[model samples]
Target: MVTGGTGVSGETAETGAGGGEALATLHRVFGYDAFRGEQEAIIEHVVAGGDALVLMPTGGGKSLCYQIPALVRPGTGVVVSPLIALMQDQVDALRALGVRAGFINSTLDFDERRTVEAEFLAGELDLLYLAPERLRVEATLDLLSRGKISLFAIDEAHCVSQWGHDFRPDYLALSLLGERWPDVPRIALTATATRATHEEITHRLNLPDARHFVASFDRPNIQYRIVPKADPRKQLLAFLRDEHAGDAGIVYCLSRNSVERTAEFLNTNGVRAVPYHAGLDGSVRADHQSRFLREEGLVVVATIAFGMGIDKPDVRFVAHLDLPKSIEGYYQETGRAGRDGLPSTAWMAYGLNDVVQQRKLIQSGEGDEAFRRRAGAHLDSMLALCETVRCRRGQLLAYFGQEPPAEGCGNCDTCLSTPETWDGTVAAQKVLSTVVRLQRERGQKFGAVQIVDILLGKRTAKVIQFDHDQLSVFGIGADLTEADWRGVIRQLLAQSLLAVEGEYGTLVLTEASGTVLRREREVPLRKEPKRPTASRSGSSGSGSGRGGKSKAPAVELPAHLVPAFEALRAWRAEQAKEQGVPAYVIFHDATLREIVTQSPATVRDLGTISGVGEKKLATYGEGVLAALHARTPPSGPAPEESPESPENPESPQSPESDWPEPPDEPGPEDWD
Candidate 1:
């Protein structure tokens, strides 16, 4: 059926779009009030038979991007997913939404797989999820050839990037989608991808001229921070105690051993935590993840593999036990937090070895030498980002080709606590001079530690044996610590002023270094390390995302509703548990806060809060209102309320002790 209507908001509603009226159908069938962002438009274009490559964030409601169109269109939507858990999750979620969905994978025995495949071929299922490996098979391809696939979606599409941190060889074979289903509109979606990775995805997925939907990388709900990695366990404990003392979160580490040790340390410190990595037994890994998702106030120490397909939106914090290799990876990992759109924290405690470890990992990988060199160079750039003396958020966004607005975010460590820097143009020159001298005398001899030792004139067996170490500049910079020199090298590398030269991949300076040597550029470098190094390469937090508190005092609503609000929260958590969904999916804290404030006695009153959709109010209003009436007496009078102050100021405001102090002046915080 053709649909006709002017656009809802000043935008044009182009006609002849694919799955015309899919949005209207979705509203009627799925009970959704409206589409979020470009969802409706993307669905319309797909109905119009155009391709799409969506770069939506994880919690941005991606499933509806294709689901609605699939249901309204003539045939099934083929969603290619890599994991069995993801397939089952989506299929179940769709079915619960009143849409028939099915998946065919190795987990199902032959009979069940055949039954599902047959159902898909018969158009009984509106959506079909398949693995890329399965899709590559002749039988699956033959089955797909007979069906009319309205649209094809490649989830986790960033896996196509060989340059990306998460690369799947099976994903490379998916490029054949163009050859197989040329007529069907295709959409590839991933929560993470930079310009380089994006290009790779486009090329490999053969999604040329596909519309690109890039959401703002800034997750305002997430408080971004990086603490100095000193006595990491203690710092983590302090952070947890101060902020997220009891909340659900993920702690990421770089290695399997670190994952185990950090999880153990955190558990001993009274944080219920589990370790996850590729090294763990399959069943154990699944159990750890299940516990993390189902249980509240649990933390999981893991590598990159754990949280990719997860939907735990209410995570109060996302902490990295080790520095990530790139800002894109870092951003994506942190995006896991505050997905329920409440305030959350993204923190990292990192030091110098994180840089060396990532560099070594890149260098040791089996790939083209030139490629490894590029990877190592990219890793150094990321290290500079982590240790940056400027606004971390600004530097991060700049790397992704988006300039953060000029105003400071006031959330990151740099913005909150500015660091001092010195003009190291001379130091840069000296370092370059040493590297050139070393290259002239011998080939790429050793790693950074060795080179620094030589420059500082540390008398060693190798230096004494190579008596020609009578170099003029040797020992001249002995006053500076090795860490200080390493910082200089990292900065120069980040600025593209240095290069790791030769097939052996030794660090050297590029032509840009000559300008610094000639004093054409003055580099303002850090005088000393501001952040401390964790004794171990990785450390898990005792509790939460301790990015520090905002100077703004906690907003005061009313104390009379404590029992009611707590009851409501408890019920919401239970509902989420029963449904096997994230608690935020049921009700966000913000909405609940409004519920307590508004004390909506009826469904009509619940509609006043901003995020309360008609369906949500219809489904949850009665229960929430019942919780509010749990029959508990009100407690003491509530503390006075104040407007939220800027978070960048001195420190977060603590609530008052006495009920009524001088109106203008806040009294001191009572130690009691």
Candidate 2:
């Protein structure tokens, strides 16, 4: 047994429990029979007083790694998190499992905070969740000094990396945890961290000695699709109507106004939706988030501000109305869907403007040269993903330094149906030639639209004023529509065959473009797929079709069992409403589906369902059994109450939503 070290004075040093005991507790306390990937090893390491760095996917059981160790170890487990909204829900969920957990943040009053502090010093808490900012206060540190900490679990550890999309300066101070309490073990966890971000986290958090447990970063159940932005609202509506009509999901926009308008548009069109962003009053944001967690089939149209530390696991899809800045940000944002191991969709509609806006923001930002360069690299990776002709999953996983699965994942848009590509050398030459001509011969720098107008011989005001009509290239692309010309231009930009310069996004020839003009390079472009009309009766494409339906949900209860499933869902919702807790907190949809499928006839039978810990089984088992009984057919033979199936572990729960409130730093626009 590892004895106490420097910080162990006046504190209990309980020997770490054996694996048998840990397994027993898993079934007794949390009602799981087995540990997930690397979980058992992680828990044993931390419980025996070893440090660790965990990089698991969103729905992977991260909390359990820390939570179980806290129970198995001698003292309170302190978790440093970012979001206040997630804190209460997490504490609530843990308490439901009969664990004594508390959190101290802005959400609590002085009296409440003091009480939690007192409980901590007395060694009464199994877990204590705190925001990173709380660690900055001297008094808070002083309070921690008086207690025994089993281990320090840093949630969303990627925030410590400056290059991380959700970077928080306060997280940098976490390095002191190692120095201040040299005896205590620490585990830093994140769902999204690339190779660079991973190294930075280890170095920044003073966790150089910690074991790095990098789980497969694949969320195979979420289908990835990227579409061209054309009437975004209509596209989104058609997406929802076709495939995900009654499903719970999130739509992320790049701006607050877009969030509001999209939410309103969805609601007006009969989709229950809410808008969430930093610009909204804190109370309103909280209310909307609470409603989203509590309601079924609700969609939240939000900025990137919405999802961090949000633990609602049944979100059916995540749709991006605008392009995110980097692949890491996209992965983190899209990982919020299909958390329950159910098939979900990750959909997006990005266009030329998204490219221009993101690039312009990066180029003009106040960051130092290195920072801007890194940002540009990140943006370039995301662009490549949008334009890639190969398997998206392969590209996405390869970005994280992992080999893609041997067989292509058939779940993404590319694998379901390969997108067609066209030889674009002629189109590229025409666009590049025009830029060279306008700059060298005409001495005129023009944007894409003006160049397009000159090519199609539109004789628009700008074209006429520039006398571009007299050029040999004028009307040369008259056969292509305005959109087609624009597509060609954007494709050129994407391929680095052209570049957008300065504040106005004017087209400029890159060194790479010179080859195309000289007929030394061939350019290939993605062919834009035909967009489905509003009046079209079917889904625009595969994955998310009309009625917002995917091929199947995470939970596919038998046809005869769906009525019982609905009954149990209704009962859970009612219980949640009465208790003012999110329905998932009472019992996740997965658990209910298990109960419905098993047709549990009594409390004993209900207790066999996954997610039914001893405490929860005692509290809600009777209610769940009754709900099942109400829907059981009269002629059906009642199965005897079966033995408790301890191995039926539910989909890993994610009470930690990671939408860190936009940090106090400069907003995205500040850079540009």
**lDDT value, candidate 2, whole model:** 0.78
Q: What is the TM-score of candidate 2?
A: 0.90
**Which candidate comes out best when scored by lDDT?**
2
lDDT of 1 by residue, 566-650 (tens): 7777898898788886555565554566567656767777665434544566777688778876744554454443343232321
**TM-scores across all candidates?**
0.77, 0.90
Question: Against the unseen true structure, what C-alpha lDDT does each candidate score?
Answer: 0.66, 0.78
Q: Write the per-residue lDDT of candidate 2 for residues 425-523, one digit (tens) a residue.
A: 998898888898999997878777788888888888877777888998999997777767777877777777777787777888888887887899889
Q: Which stretches of candidate 2 lie over 4 Å from their true place?
A: 1-19, 535-538, 541-554, 634-672
Steric clashes per prediction: 12, 25
Please tell me which predicted candidate would have the highest TM-score against the true structure. Answer: 2
